[model samples]
Target: MHLPNGIFMLQRVQTVYMIVAMLCIGALYLWFPSVEDAAGIAVIERSEPLVFGLIFASIALAVISILTYKKRQLQFVLNRLNIILNFVLLGVFVYRSLTLSGETLVSEKGIGVLLPIISIVFLVLANKAIKRDEDLVKSVDRLR
Candidate 1:
């Protein structure tokens, strides 16, 4: 089946990214790990300002991305900005994983590997979508 010009491919990857983001936010709800389990995270989490800044920035970015996807007339700036912002958020996650108090970097768990891998995949797909969008615009301009 042919995808329409404006449609986003690799949406499933974005869905997965979004799902993981949700899971991370819900992490606090799922279980408050013991201080011992917290590793370095407790120390990090307590610096309330930095953690809140990260949370709000991520939320704003997610909202912007969603709004960009929904608009019929795409703004090129938003398209590029969205990709950069997603990468920034990905960096935030990487920082959280690395600097949290308890542990060495690169846990043995398979799922931990998936997060950055997933972010990178979606970043590529989102750029592809933006390129497709610009190409479509060029085609339309040619027709005119």
Candidate 2:
């Protein structure tokens, strides 16, 4: 079983953070007026909560994978979900980046645009660890 170290013990807390972060992002998007620029980047500024929430979710998952004693199958399912989420996020960024042309650079910076890639990397690593844990479990079962 993976050891409960680092932030693994904070799953519930992290989830709460995630929910709140998503809400804040939604709110900011709703409040922001459409960019009036016609020839440059439309700065796509993001509320801080949205940024932190995403990073928090990634950290939470990493911690959960290390701390939980759940069966490998469930962990694998969670990892897959993370992967899907990452892809969706990446898609959003790609679309946004492509469309940002012909407008004033959006309020958001490149770091936010780059976050999906980082999250995807962490999710992949977490998934790999999950697989290793499964293998270890199988070996132990065979010993019995």
The candidate that achieves the highest lDDT relative to the unseen native structure: 2
Which lDDT tens digits does candidate 1 get at residues 86-137? Answer: 4664465466556655364333322332443454455456556556766887
Give, for candidate 1, the lowest lDDT window spanning 10 residues.
29-38
Worst 10 residues of 2 by lDDT: 32-41
TM-score of each: 0.47, 0.54
Candidate number with greatest TM-score: 2
Instruction: Give every collision pair in model 1.
Output: 39-102, 40-101, 40-102, 41-101
lDDT of 2 by residue, 8-125 (tens): 5345443333334333334324443223233334444443354435444544554454344355576566556655755665565566556766444333443445555555555566
Q: After superposition, how far is residue 10 of candidate 2 from its true place, in Å?
A: 9.3
**Candidate 1, superposed: residue stretches over 4 Å from native:** 1-48, 70-76, 79-117
